[model samples]
Target: MNRRLLALVAAAAVLWPAAPAQAGPATPKAPIPVDTYLRQALDGTGLPGLSAVVTHGDEVVHAAGYGHDSTGAPVTARTPMRVASVSKSFTAMAVMTLVDAGKVALDEPVAEQLPEFRMADPRAARVTVRQLLDQTSGLADGGVGIPAAEATGSPAEYVAALRSGHLAAEPGTAWAYCNANYEIAARLVEVAGGAGFGQYVRMHVFEPLGMTGSSVGGAAADGHISLFGAWVARPELRAFGARGGAGGVVTDADDMGRWLITQTGHGPQLVRPESLAAMHAPSKVRDYAMGWGPSDVDGSRLLVHAGNLFTYTAVEAIDPATGYGYAVMTNSAGLYDDTYEVLRGLVALTRGAEPPPAGGQRQLIELVLGLVALASVGLAVLGVLRPSRRRWRLIPPVLPALVFVSYPQWVSILMNGRTVTWAQVTYFAAPLTVTLAVAALSGLVVAAAHLRSIASAR
Candidate 1:
């Protein structure tokens, strides 16, 4: 028994060196700092410009802008960029201030508060102020004019145009995302605050938060679209056009940092803590809160919002458990949007999980589309060289052309009942539109050749 014990002890001693500290499971290294991860994320991203901000409680953990604007200007944290629908959060906050001041009542009818407010629907009279911010006002984008071209270009005109439109559902009974809700809310702010929408917000919200550069209607930089993996700069269709209660609000990373600090229930008390809590609480009808949508992230509450213009895209998020806020904006939007992926990567860092690598699907999609366009041209050349004997063969190709011409009317079907303008289609749908145009033009060429040959034979 003594000899056996000695042999076992000797074997254990020999095996100890093989089982060093790393032998079992390696210790996880800390997540890279926000700034470092952000720089790394920009490495392979085929984007023109990117702006990001991360806030922790009352402090700004990181704020930066990467790449260049459309004018070839280097983007910095101070570079202004359109935050898109993220503006709703600011608009919500602005309204909240009025709510706290007893200037605007949350449950009060908006039409009662703003006498100028009128919609063709009698139900519009009952729409509450809270419904607009929560996006449960029964106002929907369906049947509304695409891009709102009919507006003479003001918030008043926007509301005036709605005079002919009706409601889709009862107030507070359902939830739907519609910009008109916020626009009317902004007009209400103008009336209640006794100042222009921009002026009231500037004095009440921006001034208190030290967000000196924020404004109501403005453009930060030129927008871009991807073409065959290459970025082509394009003008914003509504670059600071009309009243900006819906989508306007050009800002920068630094300003977003300040905004986040306030949004996470930090910074100065813009509104009472209870009012702030009210803003974050999801409504009974949906997970959408006042300005942010409440979603579950790793069993914790995440308040988030995403915005997309034809030429730009952005995302803003706040993690209540950690008091961490993140915002990411890009100058380009088309084929694919990288802003959300970037936001996810940033969110992953907060969880200590390795971030998904920065990636883009636009290049691949556009390349495949370019190849299809080339194929269409080649087929047209062959058809012209030896014209098709059957007219029915040519008829099928022309149909795609009709789809493009009448796209504004039918594109809504693909977008799930959301209206779209022909100009809007030219941006997000550029590659698809171009491909369809190529095939259609090719068909027309072949048809013309066939018709000429038949005439000569006659």
Candidate 2:
């Protein structure tokens, strides 16, 4: 018996080391500091007030506001900014939730749901909710003049425009990012939820997500637009009359981050994991599914979308595998859309992987691409200006390469500053923008000369 006991004790001692090895090392949760780099980047670009939120897994480790409300008041996480097209993702998800609840069918035709809504092509009656989400509804870009107005019209007008819209492609055939498609989908939501689309999302999505400051489509209160400092005078409350599913929702970064947490199925009573998976699922008509666009980032699937509504811009992105995501809002639309890519690169870096430099800082690269585009026109101009030996061909193509790069110098400045509400740079930056105008004019001159030579030779 003594000999057996000694043998068992020896066996236990040998296995102890192996047990810890099997469990693996603990992953260190490093504190992700919000740097002045972001603030400087925004400042360097002369953006109005900006807000950013970053979350890893289920925890939002960073949420900060820079600049003031449009009224020279300090902006907080609760201070709302127009999320622009980011509203589409919420609308898409809300519609899908109704589908999951058996209140709406994904394959059902919009005409059937709302008979008052008819398409110019009677065959458009065959357009399904899935087709609209995938951007394959065969709808023309808003028609010449009247159609453009109708396309940008209110919800009722949007549906009326759809009925009057001619099919540019067959359903489920080509990709056309049509706002009307989403507007119709929002109508379906209205039909499905048996309430106004905005009201439904407010109760079902915003409140449940703990988005106290967020309002759906229309403002729950007046004064939606807030200005920061004297950087730009108080931007008035942007009209929310459209309330379409495409680019009409208002929420701050704080509420957006909370909603983003649910993208990974972390928030309360949010959409189910299965539902979220469906939103990310790729469609035959587009690489995008529902309200999200997908791309591989650092070897992981990242779902991303940006919203543009007049002067306000917003973006939301996440890596589903890592549950790492970011949301950024700026007062001016398209002012520094590329800056968001820099922020994305920072998130990638935090994940322990290296990302290339911020593309917005690469003035040389931008100049090269711009010149190349102008060169095509320049070639045509050369034929006219100097009678080139080449044929008089005009080929002008614009390439909007979505490259993500972060310059530490600029980023350090954007992130280090406090919420300073009185610093003004718009006046100086407005004149500095002349540099871009000069470059553009130079390119045009070269292109014109080439074209003139070509014409003279002909």
Candidate 3:
């Protein structure tokens, strides 16, 4: 999954009050049945498992989970699930701590600080730490060694491979959401903080907010995708090599509540308000800050970010206007993202508006594809047993088969040139992939039978 797609959350025209009411006794909003809404989402969306946390200031208003994972374990707020690219915000917090300690200069050229971040592009020499955090370094996914799969082995090897990476634009000239930005930022924290990236995050980010013993990596739940109205579990095709900041952080709703509290300017301050402000502040080049993006929900503003992996996806949002924070994580994903839909409903709940009902889109689409596949198989079987006179029609059916052959290329084009591997298409687009395969294979079988019949007639 291209994690960049996770941004903008709902394209949300989410409403927020202009300011906190003052000078009168506040009428407390009645408690909303967050559980009822979440349960509805789980059943309607056909998500195998869902977990979420809602926070108002430092208080956890709600934290719970629904359904069960592939292992038959009922998902709960405490279950470690993959938050995917949401981990970037945590990584940004870790680096900001180093910045406070005067160890990492935000504007210093990355090559000067670490010396390992060399690139064939001379413009890479000007890439700054702040630019890396804000995703304006112009380093793109096309850069050498940027893909998590390509950078295997230890953290040192990952950084070493970036020596020949190419930049998409000059530093600070534009904003592009490249995972490599966070990967390099994580490596910098390791070198500057004198600890591994995971340990550094644990020490500075999680542990400070009273979340002790929590680290980056864990045994994340098996992710699932919808196929013919059933959930099919799929293993992640690639391990985030060295597990940098970009993706592959296993956290739960319980931990997420505490993290959100810190984000919304409550609980213990991990970084000073000024430092946190930097994380939330939008870059001049784009609305994206370090790991967060600014969005206007009507007249009010909210800081939002999203996470997407093949099997699992997540989204996080903070309403600075209301000091309300939300985190939604799911253990499954597909071409359509139900995870963000749930988050949108949660935001509506915060506004005292009923969360509008949503679900069934994925199931409906998959069912139609399944029927088409069945019809293709049935037609081909009939054609083989009782041959066709016009064999020319068989050739056109074979063309759909080429899509299965060039599956990755087709998906990459759809994703705006982002790389989509063969194994990945099976998870997010399984039903569509199955339908195409059935149609193509049936074409070949029918063609062969008709060709034999033509030879006999001759």
Candidate 4:
């Protein structure tokens, strides 16, 4: 599938709920069988494990887990899954905490706080704390080689690597979702808050919100899986270190309930109400606020964010106006919109509406795509073994290589003219990347064999 379609699928999963014209009276409706809905979603998506929590004001309306996790442990409300980019709001809140203390200014040039944040383009020097939070810093995905940094280093190293990278646009001119921007923001948290980034979040955001089951950097639960053609085990979590600011908070359904309650304007006041308001306010460049993006559900405003680290995918949505919010996490990653499905269903239930059946069409389409990829590989092998004299046949054998090699460039074009690295593509879409690589390699081998056969005949 093309990147645009993939993005739309992701977005639709999170924001496509059809809420009621007006929310029903504040009287709590009979509890929807959210546990049943989540179990059904897990079965339909073929996910090995899933966890979800729904909250209304300070009450946890529903919290449950379905299937089994990586280690064959029964997934539960206490199982800690990496929340992925949902961690962005935590980072934003951390920055806001600094803002609350008068240590950080939202619109001040980031370079004023961290002199080492320079990029190859001088314009990068003007990026503000607010721009970084809202993703308008022009850093772009792969600008600082985030995938590599995520794999082997700290957020500080990730920020340091960006010094050699160029900005994708003038600072504050456009919104380009970039983890590097958060990495910088996280480092600023360290400098301004006078604590390690993770330490700061734990002491302020996580603890203050009463999310006791959550932590900044901890081993992700074992048995995490990724879907290539089928479910396969993924590696255990590496030390996220400072990169936790971008996508590295781990929490369980029980704790997520508290986090959601806080977002819905309940729980402890971790940051001032005004700061929280600013964090959710849409930025000048896009519908994105600080770390959250705003969406409309019925007439109510829903703030949403989704996260994927290849092995795990998560999404959270909160309608602060209605005091309803939910978070979903899954063990496997692919095109499946299981998390969003649960979120939408729960949101519908909260509004006293019947939840729609979860759609498994994306999974089926991905399976078909995987089968086609395998067939291409077989065709390439057959062409090599049974060489044909028609030079036209060579075109078919060589085409897959060209397509796979250019996949990154095509994705960059699709993503609002922002550049992407092969590593980032592979990390985000492993199944597609692996299939293309196999097709490309097989095609190259076949094309070479065909050329040799033609030369010999000549």
Cα RMSD of predicted structure 4: 5.2
Model 1 spans with C-alpha error above 4 angstroms: 1-30, 144-150, 239-243, 296-301, 449-458
- What are the root-mean-square deviations of the candidates from the true structure over C-alphas? 13.0, 16.3, 6.3, 5.2
By TM-score, the better pick of 1 and 4 is: 1
Taking the tens digit of each residue's C-alpha lDDT, what string does model 2 give over 87-118?
A: 77888888888988988778888777777778
Put down candidate 1 lDDT per residue, 60-81, tens digits, no spaces.
9889888899889998899877
TM per candidate: 0.88, 0.67, 0.88, 0.86
TM-score of candidate 2 versus the correct structure, residues matched by position: 0.67
lDDT of 1: 0.77
List where candidate 4 sits over 4 angstroms from the true fold. Answer: 1-32, 142-152, 226-229, 236-242, 296-301, 377-387, 412-428, 441-458
Q: What Cα-based lDDT does every candidate model obtain?
A: 0.77, 0.59, 0.79, 0.76
lDDT ranking of the models: 3, 1, 4, 2
Q: Give the lowest summed-lDDT range of ten residues in model 4.
A: 1-10
Clashes of each: 0, 38, 0, 1
Model 1: ten consecutive residues of lowest lDDT: 1-10
Candidate 2, after superposition: displacement of residue 171 in Å? 0.5
Please provide, for model 3 over 127-156, each residue's C-alpha lDDT reduced to its tens digit, 9 standing for 90 to 100: 999999998999776665455534466566
**Native-vs-model 4 lDDT?**
0.76
